[model samples]
Target: MTASLEAKAGIRRHAPAASRHAYVTLVTNDDYARGATALTHSLRHSGTQADIIVLHTPALGEASREALAALGCRLVEADLLPLSDAFNARHARRALHGAAPFTKGRKPDFHTPLDNFVKLRLWQLVEYESCIFVDADAIVLKNIDRLFAYPEFSAAPNVYESLRDFQRLNSGVFVARPALATFAAMQERLDVADAFWPRTDQTFLQTFFPQWHGLPVTFNMLQYVWFTMPDLWDWKSIQVLHFQYEKPWETNHPKSEVLMPLIALWQAFHDGGPIPDIAALPGPSGPAAALSPSAGA
Candidate 1:
């Protein structure tokens, strides 16, 4: 067997053997509060035994902070200082801009998954032995305890392999070890100077850990295909469902109806009277309406 084969086997062997604590981190910016809120409730409802936290930029005002605080999670400010250490001020600012892509426009600012990738490193710094980073747009359908069965590099592959322009991995969900050195080494490869610089975080990661394979597709089901895979609907097969395109609150989402469970959970817990009307969602071409009433108004 080749060295890569030996290493893969070794990593797999260590995956189930390591006993560790698991926590979930949802990284967001101001605009994605609804998705973040829904995710918190979904994870809590599933009785995830791990600590849950939100990582948002410092610009979030007191009212928003207090609101997220009410969810009973430890709110962490993904501030400037640490990022300054990893990247220069200009790059840090660019990274900050990337993290909150929901702001400014319906589309994300950067072409790469840098936001999620950076948050993954940020979560590692916070001291969780093993951490699961879920996008704010995702909801947990079942206890994903077995995800901990894998080691530092685990994720789901993109449905279209040809889309791997630079071999970018999927950013929706992943699990990793807290070993900073391993990640730092990965960052070195992401050296802001690479000629074939990754357009997204996953691409950089794909290059960093060439040996990383993805988890079974069932774990990170893409919402776009609920109709395509209805026959494969073992709800238990899905641990975290990614709301990739049209979020539950977005207008004209062909599949927002599919997120009824999440919408119901949001209504039951949030003091906000009722979820927005599905009819109010933009009809596919228009921009997504904001979750906050002011934005909607």
Candidate 2:
């Protein structure tokens, strides 16, 4: 078998056995490929021993794939979910955005609603016993290997603006087990007639596992909490910082001024520079300066 095939089959040429757990992230384009690179750097910086896996679509260029491979990230080519044409049409860029506009923050032009559903392909990776799926736009602040012990379908609540926002789960970071049965089950419920997922994979995953275990918010701390809920912004406790809406890579985006501090943090990881002390990083001025009234997916 080829080297890539052997790795997928859990038969590494050097190691006695491949790690049963891995950190998985997705990249569809060059923008997200940059995010994935930084995420891998941060994961290595945190001293994680598990494998780093980057699942990319065909849209990603060869340069991006080579960059990720240089960082010791196992590359897997993931295809968009095989849904009916009607389902894909419903979630197309313009259609989904028109039906459910993002009033709080501007989603970058490259953000495709259908690309989000590709996350579900993680389930098809049955080679790994367990996996922690973190969004490409997020960086690991601390070693979170302990998350592997957490049960399947465990994710942090979507809390950014207020306590009331905890009603839903955030798929930005979650622990899941790899099982073909589960993958098949998700496909069964994903594309029924008139079936619509407003938040794409986030909504569908939440529905697929209604009784999902709730991880502490610190595990997947959303960037908005820095301003909207400053009281909850404990840098020392945050394990992962997720740039949920406005990515740090964008130049002079709408919320650039407000998110400069967080953006700087992401840049440090992306550039492989000396990371600043998390505890010493300044917090928001106050809750009064809350930028957006609503939370994003």
Candidate 3:
């Protein structure tokens, strides 16, 4: 889908030198458009003061593009990432479902946008001193603008813990400082096949920012946490719901019925309505009482 001339120009100038830190996400097509739509909606409802932006590639169909523009959030056009399977940032999320996700995924399409690499592209947005990248597959449960106070490379740990010792932080949510140098550094290392752990950008980020500050577990609540450790996450206490699996969009998803409320909630944002602004979000909730070592750190 082609962006309108006005939107195309607006995308180029959306980030002003005076702008402060902001929230960003990506949308590739109808599937992710739905998620991005809801995400922006929740952000507004939760009272986020920072600018909201949607970074998208040409693969986004015309309808999706116009729909997002109608949301009034800035739309920045991102080039398709050159790396293989790097176009879509959802690979790691898909891997969370099972070793083979093809069976459950949408029918293969001819055009696959480069989404994963866009994560690195965030560094190219030099105008903002900092940014919070919330995966579109999530919804904000409360105002999380206070997270802007944290330093760069801050993120929550992946909710899934394997029998193996290795546990990568979920890129579903993160705070980063966008810089050209960091973007260049990532590109230089992309050629190394082993650069990305488990063949996804989540690991590349972990390797690049090994000393990243940690956000509270409540910042990005994954579906698996509710499935595997319910006590650790209280919906009333959480900030965002990272739709780890069984997304609200898929009619047959196991969590579809229970998570159905999220649809109307997302729609309210998509359709337009009043929501709390940044100043009114619930009191900053602390991490769970028994946060994992990586989580509470």
Candidate 4:
């Protein structure tokens, strides 16, 4: 931030988008928009100098878009599903999200689940040398600039003990090079894959990069431990706290006691001050809450 436009223009020439590094995420609907905003706010609060990028579908409302823009994030909107016969049947509506072995409320069943795959579009950020993707439903407790030093392809293990597990390489937080060639490769692979196993972008990525480096658990310490075994919770060392279905916005749920404290941190970033009591999100309001288009497109 300098006063001289000529100096700034010179700087921009040196720091073209090709040399940029960023943190990326996505929001296909209003439900996750709030979380994405919090994520951006937290990154800025952590003093990151690199770009904070978000890939969203056109369905996102102006409020959510403005919220992200307010954090100095670069929001790139794109049409995720292209009109082509090359599409994979695995991504078809019925096969989307794969087998729902989890409880009813654990995952989305509608077209909402389909847009989750759009995260793969991250590779299209060809201008970036490398980018770290963090799921919107997460909290960045501290600066994680260290991730930028790791390999172009790296991620923390999922909430599991064995790396061999399908979900062990969590897609929630990862570092990767962004290139058009790689993006095309991913698109081609998706077109040919029988199905996105376990039904998500993580599975597709696991298939593509078998030798990806594994980052330490501190980078993506999940909150699952707190919910399953409250006594064993270790709050001090966490770099990121990921909340899935029952995110911070859903405040009226029965887990208010467990959620409020965690939600407080996100509120602190969102409000730009002391964290207030978290509350349930009201029904979608005004044009910002327009009915989202089907992802089948």
* C-alpha lDDT score of every prediction, in listed order: 0.53, 0.86, 0.65, 0.65
Candidate 4 overall lDDT versus native: 0.65
Best by lDDT: 2
Cα deviation at 234, candidate 1, in Å, is 4.0
lDDT (10s digit) by residue, model 2, range 148-201: 999999999999878997879999999999887998888899999999888899
State every prediction's TM-score relative to the real structure: 0.64, 0.91, 0.74, 0.77
lDDT (Cα, 0-100) at 255 in candidate 2? 74
Q: Which regions of candidate 3 fall more than 4 Å away from where they truly are?
A: 1-18, 84-114, 161-167, 193-196, 257-297
Writing each residue's lDDT as its tens digit, candidate 4 over 228-285 gives: 4344345555677776555666645434444455666667776667533223322123
Minimal lDDT window, size 10, model 1: 9-18
Model 1, residue 79: displacement in angstroms?
3.4
Q: Alpha-carbon error at 163 in model 1, in Å? A: 12
Better of 2 and 4 by TM-score: 2
> At residue 55, what lDDT does model 2 achieve?
79
Candidate rank order under lDDT: 2, 4, 3, 1
